[model samples]
Structures are given as structure tokens and as C-alpha cells.
Target: MRVAGLVLAAGGGRRYGRPKALVRHGGSLLVERASRTLIDGGCDPVVVVLGAAADPVRAVADLRGCLVVDNADWVTGMGSSLRVGLGALLATDSVAAVVLLVDMPGVTAEAVRRVAAGAGPAVLAAAGYPPGRRGHPVLLGRDHWAGVRATARGDTGAAAYLRAHRARLRIVTCGDVADDRDLDVPADQRGGRRG
Candidate 1:
């Protein structure tokens, strides 16, 4: 099955005080890293949704070999971005999408690969962390795109839809292979090393 990669990078980063997509991590922009992770994870025709500071992100992020989508309603919330990303993928031959967050610098390509493996048009999968915590790099089958778009509102992207169908959701254990830490605060950008 062909799976596309969707990177949500359209947030205003109000809490972080800057666009997370442009934020630097490990010598590269977060958006660049996220896109690379998706590509390395076996997703083809990756689509990146850009909203806040879209121009700057486009100018800086090496988005070659990927489709860049603009979300005008980004400030409304992540749902809009998710909708936009999934909508863009509708034009492709992808049967599903591996959704990743640009702020999640700790999530690895391996985790995405694991969650995307064997995903069919009706499969719903998410990366499971230790202690039964669920996180990103979620696999959304083409069959659920319409419902996800309908319920996606504010910052709650597909959470409600996923919850409604949790019984059928596949949990791919990734705690042992990847970390799902998100860069939400200034301290998170400090690399956890006090100078």
C-alpha cells in the first residue's frame, strides 16, 4: 500500500514564542528534520503543511522532493492543518498517511516506519509509548480522512475521531526505539543541558 507522509508545521507557536517549524534542532530547522524523518521512514510524496511564517519556512527548510501545502486557517488550530494536509494527499495515490508533528523533535523515522508498516486503506495506527501513552506519527487510512476532517477542530486534530474508533486502532510500540517528546517551551529548545 502506498502511504504518504504528512508533516504538520503550520502552528503559530504562541507558547514557544516562535514558529516551531523554523526552530533549529541538531543544526537543522525542525521542519527540515520532520520532512527528512518522513522520507527516511518510507513515506513517498511527503506533504508539509505550512501556515505561520510560511514564507520563511519555505525559504529555509530543504523541502525538495516533497509537496508544500499552505493552510490559511492555521491560526484556528491543528485541525485545519490536518485537514489541509490530508486534502492535499487526496490528489495522490496514497492509501494512507503517516502524520508527524514538526515540534516533535524526538520522534524518529523508525517509529514512523513501524506505525506505517502494513497499514491498509482502513487501518488506524498510532505509536505507543511506555506506560500505554499514545503519540504521534499516527497512521490514518484513506477511509478515515473524511471523518477526521469533519471532526478536526481547534487544536484537537483527529483526537475525537480516533477516540470514537479506538477499539480498532492499532498501537505500535515505539517507546524502545523512539522518543515522542515535543518542543513546546523555551526550555525544551535548550537541549536539556544547563550551561
Candidate 2:
């Protein structure tokens, strides 16, 4: 079965000041980096959910070859973005989606590959970092989309559903290939959010 990519890039980044999707890091916008990562990771089709400064982001980000969707409720938080991203893929042939946050520039395609190694409509997996920490690049199977959408709310987003299904979650160790450190502040400025 095919495993697609879903990027939640709709946050306004109240903490980081500007929207995370527009944040430039390592010579590329966060949204561009995220979409590229998914494409490089072997995901057949990638979808980016835009919110906050959606129009401005589209004007500059290199989101070519990917499906871009808008989240009118993005100000509400990541949950709404997740719901929208999942909803967009409801008609696709992909059996699962490997979710990536736009703010996490450190997560590599290798990490995405590991998490999506054996994705399926019934499979559930997530990347695990050092010292026993389960983090992003989460692989959510099609079977649980409805439940995830129903419970997804606020900034927590898919976290609530993953926590409840911890037993079924296949933790893929990705510490060797990637880091989940997110850009919290511009150093020159103050804070930020994720995509």
C-alpha cells in the first residue's frame, strides 16, 4: 500500500512571532523543508496544510509537486490542521500518512523512511529519539483516521490519539539518523509554532 505525507503547517506561531511555515532556516522556508523531506523519504504524494499566513507562504515557498490545502481554523491550533490534512487524503489511494511538522528542520528523510518502513491501513508507528522518547514523523494508518480526527483538538493534535494507542504504536528508533529539535526562537527574537 502507498504511504503519503502530511505536513501540518497551519500554526500562527504566536510564541515564535511569525508563522513557522514562513520561518527561514538553513536557506529554505520551513514548509519547503518539510515537503522536501517527505518527498525524499519515498512518500509518493505529499500534502501540506496551510494556515495563518497561508497566502504569503504560497507566494514564496517552493511547494511544487505537492497538494496544498488551507485550514481556516488553524488559529485554533494543530488539531484542526491535522483534521484538514487527513480529510484531504480521504479520497486518495494511500493507506497511511507520515506526518511531519514544518518547524522540525532536524528530522531527516531517513527518519521518515524508518517510520514508514512497513506502513499499512492498519499500521501505527512513530519515530523514537534518544533516551526513550517517542516523537514526530508519526505514521498513522487509515483505519484510525476517524478516531484521530474526532479527538484531535488544540495544539496537542494527534498526540492525544497516539497516547491512547500507545500499546499498538510501533516505535522506530531514529536517534541515529535524525534529531527532533524544533526552532523555538529566532535567538534575535522570542518564540514559534510548528507546521
Candidate 3:
């Protein structure tokens, strides 16, 4: 099964001073990096959910093969973006999707590949730090899409659904390949100490 990818890049980033999708890191927009990460990680079709400053992101980002989704309710939170991204995937032949957050620049293509390796129609896996620190690039099989869509609320994303079904979840250790820390404020882009 070809695992798809979802990049949730809709947040206005009130705390970060602007939309994270337009933020530059390593000379490329965050949105561009994320979309490329998924494609390079072996995801056949990638979907990018955009909300805040969607037009500017579309104009500059090289999202040639990505399916761009405009989440109108993005002001509400990450939940809406997740819901929108998942909904878009559910309509296609996508067996599963690996969800990546736009602000999490530390996550790499290798980490995404690691997390997506265990994808299936009934699989649920997430990248984990040492000692099982669950993080993004979560792979949700089609079987759990409805559950995630229902439980995802506010900025929680799949936390509620994942928590309820913790026993069946697979934790992929990606601490060596990537970092899950996200940029929340402008200072976060100052190359903060990673410890």
C-alpha cells in the first residue's frame, strides 16, 4: 500500500507572529520543506492543508504535485486542519496517511519514512522519542480515520483518538533520525538549544 502524506500548515501562528507555512528555514518556506519531506519519504500523493495566508504560500511554494486543501475553519485550531486533510484523503484510494505538522521543522524525511513503514488499512503508528515520547508524523490507517476525525478537537489533533486506543498503537523510535520539537514563537527560529 502506498502511504499518503498530510501536511497541516494552516495555523495563523499568533504566537509565532505569522503563519508558519510562510516562515523560512534553510532558505525554503516551511510548507515547501514539509511537502518535499513527505514526497521524498515515499509517500505517493501528498496533501497540504493551508489556511492562513494560503494565497502567498501557493504563489511561492513549489507544491507542484501536492493536493492543496484550503481549510476555512483553520482559525479554530489544528483539529480542523487535520479533519480537512483526512477528509480529503478519505475520498481517494489512500490506504493510509502520515500526518506531519508544518511547524515541526526538526522532523525529517527519514523520520517520516520510519513512521510510515508500518502503515496499513488498520495500522496506527507515531514517531516516538526515547522512552516512548509520542510525536507527529503519525500514520493513521483508513480504519481509524473516522475515529480520529470524530475525536480530533481544537489543537489536540489525534491525541484523543490515540489516547483512547493506546494499546493498539505502534511507537516507532525516531529519536536518532529526527527531532519533534516545534517552533511556537519568533525566538524559536533563533536556533534555540536542542537538549
Who wins the lDDT comparison?
1
TM-score of each: 0.97, 0.95, 0.96
Model 3: per-residue Cα lDDT over 33-100, one tens digit each: 89999999999799999999999999989998999999999999999999999999977898899999
lDDT of 2 by residue, 101-130 (tens): 988888999999999998999899999987
The C-alpha lDDT values of all candidates are 0.93, 0.91, 0.91
Query: Model 3 scores what on Cα lDDT?
Result: 0.91
Between candidates 1 and 3, the lDDT winner: 1
After superposition, the stretches of candidate 3 with alpha carbons farther than 4 Å from their true spots are 193-195
Candidate order by TM-score, decreasing, is: 1, 3, 2
RMSD of each: 2.3, 2.6, 1.3
